[model samples]
Target chain A: MKKHNYSAGPCILPQEVFDKSAQAILNFNDSGLSILEISHRSKDFVAVMDEARSLALELLGLEDKGYKALFLAGGASLEFLMVPYNLMKEGGKAAYLDSGTWASGAIKEAKFFGETVVVASSKEENYNNIPKGYSVPADADYFHCTSNNTIFGTQMKEFPSLDMPIVCDMSSDIFSRVLDFSKFDIIYAGAQKNMGPAGTTLVIVKEEILGKSGRIIPSILDYEKHIKAESMYNTPAVFPVYASLLTLQWLKKLGGVAAVEKLNNAKAELLYNEIDRNPLFKGAAAVEDRSNMNATFLLNDAAHTETFDTMWKAAGISGIPGHRSVGGYRASMYNAMPIESVQVLVDVMKALEKAI
Target chain B: MKKHNYSAGPCILPQEVFDKSAQAILNFNDSGLSILEISHRSKDFVAVMDEARSLALELLGLEDKGYKALFLAGGASLEFLMVPYNLMKEGGKAAYLDSGTWASGAIKEAKFFGETVVVASSKEENYNNIPKGYSVPADADYFHCTSNNTIFGTQMKEFPSLDMPIVCDMSSDIFSRVLDFSKFDIIYAGAQKNMGPAGTTLVIVKEEILGKSGRIIPSILDYEKHIKAESMYNTPAVFPVYASLLTLQWLKKLGGVAAVEKLNNAKAELLYNEIDRNPLFKGAAAVEDRSNMNATFLLNDAAHTETFDTMWKAAGISGIPGHRSVGGYRASMYNAMPIESVQVLVDVMKALEKAI
Candidate 1:
């Protein structure tokens, strides 16, 4: 069957990006050595590393500043602990906003190393909206937030008004918009969503925020260690990093983040409008809190569930199944998801509504 | 230049493996979705995951065993920490033979989670040989060893004389030899070396060794967590895992570990013979302790370095530069390397000898 991928993460990628990436993996940058077969230190691989780092900074509008861009291993989950281990000082505290599963996971990892003050949480409201009236600690090490909740379809929408360092798990929505990165001291994301693949982690940190933690971090878990080593702290996730670099090149050639962000919103609105207009379907999260990347919804009651599922699958759309945790459907509209896929999904929704 | 890749890890791959892997990255298994874009939970992805897991067990000869195979995101460097995080009881002791860099790294991570006993250490001799005369403590939770040192070119060569549960980092030399799996409690390797790429880590662990560590492990760092979650506790390193699986398939079709081991022996022998015969080349590691995967040697005089380097590069050989920490040359002959590459290097050495 012709398939359109709507998987939440490990999600869709551009055809050009994948083609270029595959070629590189086989024989990187025409170096006659597969990206998979070269030293991370080779001049070719180093260029990949440098270009990837520079692009990340460029995407975030931090190219002129001295912020170091790193592609490290162990994903953002490792960064949860590493962030605290590097920046959380002895007797220091970090402010956290518990917006979703990933946010809570970050809280748990941070607690392992230092004290955390959860300034706001949407758990009481089932994470349908970003919490309001968060009390940021004036003396806190940093304020942490999950920029977009993939499961619940919520985004911070705007930067948290903070006087302290703001760290974010921008795992799902990193390049989806033109983010004002200066407001955040550090931003980390797994590459599965908007970046490339699932092995390397993209970290952008202000150089001045490091070296305060009293804890002795294991070398692999240290941020400065990675920055100093230029993410070749060890032989890094070479293929993933290389793939991510190709994707970045694709992003640049497609006229950068601003160009994609416009298309992304159009795709999101297409599916979201269908949900609002269709009688049988209702958006799962609050309209104001809807995620531009992942659209979550449920068939009103159980009667039309099987029908909608069958129609979408027959239309060659996949991963629109809602997370069992949320009990409905989620259409992950990452950058590579063409607007046509969303329109087809919208058509499926209308057909299901008419059938009902 | 048509480069010959001998880059210790992130080493060589079969041309066919790269071809298929590259195609899958663009469009996976004919699903019309890039491999990186698919949900790990999708049936197609699950099938890829299952096949890769099965192949790992088959390669290690663990089909009918009390074992579970997992493909994890963190490289073995992270596994160095995770092994103890999941297996070590609070204050419980583990025994480790400090063979080289990896073993020492693992030792550092294990000590953070529990008490660690260094059974023996070769730091006195810079880890040129596996330490002898180590007594395993019955009270020890597990015994750890690195199967081979990529830097020093030393391997365990035989199962360590131990009675406790055994764990090993076979990152550099896995699949280069035929070995009994009955002795190990857990075995892991970063995929960069013999398996495939650098993003994925392969683990074979007895299920019973889990649930012993009473601490709460961060979800991603927990091996037990990954095992329970079926290696998809998070978005996996899809591209590298698929490539590793393809490489394993290639190995299986080439007649499994035994046939590959014979070819590996011939490659190592050709280079080692040249080193022994040529007056210009001096091996850094003990002869008995040499690794079949990476051969470390120094030119007779530093002045001869550029001559041999130019000769090798003209012949399309690359990445034989030794690690800066131990400068000379290192010809890593991982499984993907054609023996002709080694023969060419051997011929280069002979020509250098005659020229001198």
Candidate 2:
């Protein structure tokens, strides 16, 4: 049975991308070498780096704009440190909107390099909705925000436009919709979610925003150095980058983000509608702020929990368990997740409601 | 034709390991999901992390000997900065042995954290030999060295026994031989040579050596934090770590490092003997300090270069081109390289001599 992958990250990739990446691992470009063992500097791998970088910008409609895309190792956790290490200067302050766990993580790391002001937070409500009506300080170096809360299942429908540089952590929802790309000076995503695998993080930074922090950044942590080296400043996570490139190609062939967003909306609507109509389940997040990518819900009566869990397991569904803090269910419908999988989950919910 | 792999890093891996890894990428442990898309926190991947960590220590004969092994991102280059960040104190100095490019790189990063003393170096002699009889300072925080010079083909036959902590960059020669595993306070190697792939780096550190620097260490660069996190401090490079786990299992099944050493020695001897006898070729490094992993050599007559290059290419041997700085050929005979492949290279050398 084809299991529906709804894991928050290292989640579903396009089937074709997975197939091509598997073939590459066996024999990369017929070089008789596994992609795992090929040098990052090799021509085949270099082409992968080039294509992945360009496709990211192209998909965001930021191609030929000032944005430069980079594929790097260490995931978003590393980016949490690097973003501040490279951008937040000594004695400077940055504004952060803490929507959920990842937002708090970024805020903690940024505090290590400089003063961080929580412009707004939904923490008071257990992050069940996106914060609003927070004022961005004019003196702040940059405004940082998480576009989607993977744990709370809340996503900002629109970013707050500000004159200062805007840095967004789009880790869980980058390619799932179309966003105004030029508004943010920096955008980063952990590849495991919507991009590729877990090893490489995708960073798209405007070149002008770097080196303004006046801190003596370590070369490895320096964003400018990575861009100068074309993301091969060190031996890149070659296989992950190659897999990400294949995924970007798949995204492009699926008519880029615009086409994928239509399917994503439909998938979310199917499950959200089921949760609304079925008496056994209730939605976890506010209806206005709920994430189209991650849908969180729980059994309305609590007695049907075991029955619903077993049904979903038998239905060949995986990773629908909500974050421990929420204690319900979270189905992360990334761009690669087909609508059929969402239908499966909705059908399970409807059947459980009828049977219970 | 089945080509022989000899590329330095991201070089070669066991055929069975490749097969198994490729299968995992398709459907990991019958979970009906690609390993490329599986969550890093999943039981399957966690098991891989556990097994790989234990196997590394077991193969090195350091199991339960106060050494903790961790898999991290960014390769050895990241370690160059992290080692000093986590180990060297604000007012202290560390001694470094500048054997080759990587060692020099480490020395440079260490200098950024604190004062560095070059206790020993062979840079004047083009790093063709490992320095001996250089005194390590008793007051230095730690003594750092590179066990193998991939570019110049020099290998330290024995480590300098000292009371101070010993940190080693064993990127090229790790797992190719058996060494006194307890002697070093820290051992780090990029998983490209003799291990698995390019994205993940293996770090084995003595627990007692951490948290002594007193400087504020970034969580990502903190070795103690990574060890506590069991190398999943963040989303690790999932595919590379999985591939590395497979390679480590392959090493353990092949009688561990002790058994692999015998074959490694044999392969080195076969190629070194051929280089000595062939008038067309001359070894680059000092015979006493030559690496069993990388054999650097040049044609005795530069005029025979095209002929020798053609002969090796025709023999289906790859990755023999030496570092541009060395301007010769480097046949890196890593652990996964079969003796039959080395014999083929030897036969090509002999054929070139005959034809010349």
Candidate 3:
């Protein structure tokens, strides 16, 4: 049976991505050697790394804009530490918006560097909505924000226009929507969600924003060193980068991020509309702030839980169990998730309403 | 035609591992979801992480000991920074043995934390051999060494005994040979060589040696945090970890590291004997310090380079061109390389001699 995987991360990718990646694993680029076993410095693999970095920037429409893309090894969690290590100066202050779990985690790491200020937070509301009326301190070295909250199912619709460098963690919603990507000086995402797999992280940094942090930085944690080496400072995550390239290629074929945004918006509308229209269900997040990538909803009455769970399982819908903190169902509609899958989920919800 | 792969690190893995890994990329463990598309928290993948971790300790003969194995990212380069962060005390000193490029890289990162003493260095000899008759500072926080030098083709036949902790970077030679295994306090290897691919790194650290650094460690670089999280503190390199599990299974099935060590020694002897007998070729590293995993050699006369190179290419030998720093040929014989492949390369060397 075909499985509709809505896994929050390390999540669904294009079927074509899987097929090509499998072929590469068996015999990469007709070299008769598994991609798993080739030297990363080999001409063929270097081409892969180069293309992956180029495609990541090109997809974001940040090409030729003084931005360099790096496919790094550690996930966004490492970025939490690298961001402060690279951007925060000696005795510097960084401003951040507390939006969700990941945002809070980034905040925790930032505090280790120097003074960190929370510009605004929706934590009082269990992060049900993106906080507004936040003011960034003019003296901050940088203003950081999480573009989307996967756990809370909320996404910032508008980013603050700050004179300081702007950084965004777009881990779950990087290529799923169209945005003025150049507005942010540094944008990073773990590849598992919309891009490819779990091993690599995509970091697109405007070169101008680096080297300002006077604090001595370790070579591995320094953005400038990675950019200078073209993300080959050390051995990179080869298979993940190649898989990400395949995914980026798939996105380009689908008419880039703009076209995918439309498909994604449609998928979100289909699922969100069902959650709102159905008497049995209520969306968990604030209606206006709901994430287009992940739609979190809960049954209006607790008695219908078992029925809905069984129905989704029988329909071959997988990984929709909401995060433990949210206590609901989260249908993650990343770029690769088909609207047909969303429809199947909605049909299951509809069946639950009738059966109840 | 079958090709012999001798690329150092991100080198050859078993053919069965390739087949199994490719199949998992399509559908993992009959779960009807690509391994790349599944959550790390899922029961299936959690099982994979557990088994890989357990197998690592089991194969190292350290399961019952107070040690933990973590599959981390950022390769051994990150660990260079991490080792000092987690072990070196505030304003304290750490001792290092400079054997090759990677060992020097580690020493560079160690210098960032506190006083780093190079207890012994073979750099003056162009890293042609491991240095001997030098002593580590008794009061240093810990002592560090590389078990094998891929570029220089030298392996440490002995380790220093000290009251302080001992850390080994076994990136190129882990699982290729048998060692006491419990002599070191910490061991790390980039999985690309004998384990799996380039994405994940294997870290085996004794439980008792952590949290003494007195330095505030970032969560990502903190080994204790990773160990406490059971190697899932963040999204691990899913595909690499899974592939590593496959390789470990292969090693265990083939009677584990001890059995593979005998085969590796035989392979090294066959190639080294030819290098010694062939009047045209000369081994790069000192005879007593030659590595079993990577054997670096050169043509006695530079004029024979083109002919030998052409002959090896014709014989379907790949990735044996030495690192640019050491301008010669390096034949890397990782665990998965067949003895038959070594015979093929030996035949090519003999052919080169006859043609010249």
Candidate 4:
């Protein structure tokens, strides 16, 4: 049975990506060498690295705009430390919006560098919605925010324009929707969600914002050194980067982020509309702030829980269990998740209402 | 014809690992979903992480000892920074041995944290030998060294008995030979040579050595935190870790490290003997310090280079060109490299001598 996999991260990629990447593992580019066995500096892999970097920028429509896309090891969690190490000057202050677990994690690491101010936090509300009407300090080195909260199922619809560099953690929502990517100086995403797999992170930084930190950054943590070395300062996550490239190529063939955004919007609407119309279920996040990629919802009454769960399982629907912090179900619809999967979940919900 | 691959790091792995990992990408463990599409927290993947970690310690004979094995991202280069971060106290000193380019790189990173002392250096000799008779500063936080110098084709035959904690970067020679694994506090290797691929790093650290630095380490760079998280502090390098587990299983099926050590010794002897007997070729490193994993050699006369290069290429040999700094040929025979490939290279060397 083909599962309608909705696992939050390290989730579904295009079927073509799985097929092509698997082939590369066996015989990469007809070289008769497994991609796993080739040197990172080989012409074939260098081409892979180059193309992945450029294609990332091209999809975001940030080409030749003083931006360098780097496919680095250590997922977005490591970026929490590197962001502060690269952007926070000695005794610098960084302002962060604590919207969810990951956003708070980044703020914790930032506090190690210098004064870290939480501009606003939805934590008191269990991060049920994006905090609003917050202001970043004018003198802070940079203002950081998470575009989407995977755990809370909330996404910021608007970003505040600030004089200082604006950094966004787009780990779960990058390449899913079309946004003005240039509005932020630094945009990063873990490849696990919508991009590729779990090993690599994509960091898109405007070159001008780097080298001003004044702190003595270690070479591995230094963004300037990585850019100077063209993202090969160390052996990159070779297989992940190649898999990401195949995913990006798949996205491009389907008309880039713009086309995918349309598909994603339709999927979100189909699921959200059902959640709203059904008397037994209610959305977990604020309707206005709900994420397009992940829809969190719960039964209005606990009586229907077992039947609903059994129905979804019988329908071959998997990975809809919500995070422990937010109890219920979370149907994650990344770019590769077709609307047909969302409909299956909706049908299960409808079946529950009828069977009851 | 199957090409004999000798690329340094990101080199060859067992044929079975390639096939099995590729199959996993399509439908892992008969789970109906692609491995690339499954959650890392899933039961199947958590099982992989547990098995990979335990099998690593089991093969190293470190199980039941106070050691923990972690599969991490950022490769061995990241370990260069992480080691100092988690071990060195603030305002402390570290002792290092300058054996090769990678060792020098580690030394550079350690300097960023505190005073780094070079206990001994073979750099003046172009890293063609490992220095001996050097004493580490007892008061230093830890003593760091590289067990194998991949670029210069030298391996340490003995390590000094020191009171301080000992750390070794075993990126090239790990799993290829038997060593006193418990003597070191921390052992890190990029999973490219004698392991699996390039996306993940294998770190074996003695549990007692952690959290003693008294420095506020970032969670990502904190080995203690990673150990506590069971090596899943964040999403791990899932595919690479799985492939490494497959390779480790392969090694065990062939009778573990001791058995592979015998094979490695035979391969190294087969090539080193030919390099010594062939009038046209000479070994690069000191005979006493020659590496069993990577055997670097030079043509006695540069005039025979063209013919020798042609002979090797015609014999289906690839990735033998050496580092630009050395300007010769480096045949890297990691654990997965069969002795048959070494024989083919030896035949090519003989044919080159005959043609010349």
Top candidate on DockQ is 3
Residue-by-residue lDDT tens digits, candidate 3, A51-76:
99998888888999999999998999
User: What TM-score would chain B receive for each of the candidates shown?
Assistant: 0.97, 0.99, 0.99, 0.99
Tens digits of per-residue lDDT for model 4, A1-356: 86999999989999999999999999999999999999999999999999999999999999999999999999999999999999999988999999999999999999899999999998999999999998889999999999999887899899999999999999999999989999999999999998998899999999999989988899998999999999999999899999999999999999999999999999999999999999999999998999999899999998888888889999999999999999999999999998999999999998898998
Q: Note the DockQ of each predicted structure.
A: 0.66, 0.76, 0.90, 0.88
Against the unseen true structure, what C-alpha lDDT does each candidate score?
0.85, 0.90, 0.93, 0.94
| Total clashing pairs in model 3 | 0
Better of 2 and 3 by lDDT: 3
Instruction: For candidate 1, give the lDDT of residue B83.
Output: 84
Q: Per-residue lDDT for B211-312 in model 3, tens only?
A: 888899888889999998999999999999999999999999999999999999999999999999998899999999999999999998999888888888
Once fitted onto the true fold, the runs of candidate 1 whose alpha carbons sit more than 4 angstroms away are A1-3, A353-356, B136-139
The predicted structure with the larger TM-score, 1 or 2, is 2
| Chain A TM-score, structure 1 | 0.97
lDDT of each residue in A157-267, candidate 1, tens digit only: 877677777899999999889977888889999999999988889999998888877777777888888889987888778778877887888888888899999999899
Chain A superposition TM-score per model: 0.97, 0.98, 0.99, 0.99
Kindly report the root-mean-square deviation of model 4 from the true structure over all alpha carbons.
0.7
Least accurate stretch of 10 residues (summed lDDT) in model 4 chain A?
Answer: A301-310
* Sliding window of 10 residues with minimal summed lDDT for model 3 chain A: A299-308
| Model 4 stretches astray by more than 4 angstroms | none
Can you write out model 4's per-residue Cα lDDT over B1-356, one digit (the tens) per residue?
88899999799999999999999999999989988989999999999999999999999999999999999999899999999999999999999999999999999999999999999999999999999999888899999999999999999999888898999999999888888999999999999898888899999999998889999999899998899999999999899999999999999999999999999999999999999999998999999999999999999899988888888898889999999878799999999999999999999988887876
| Ranked by DockQ, top first | 3, 4, 2, 1
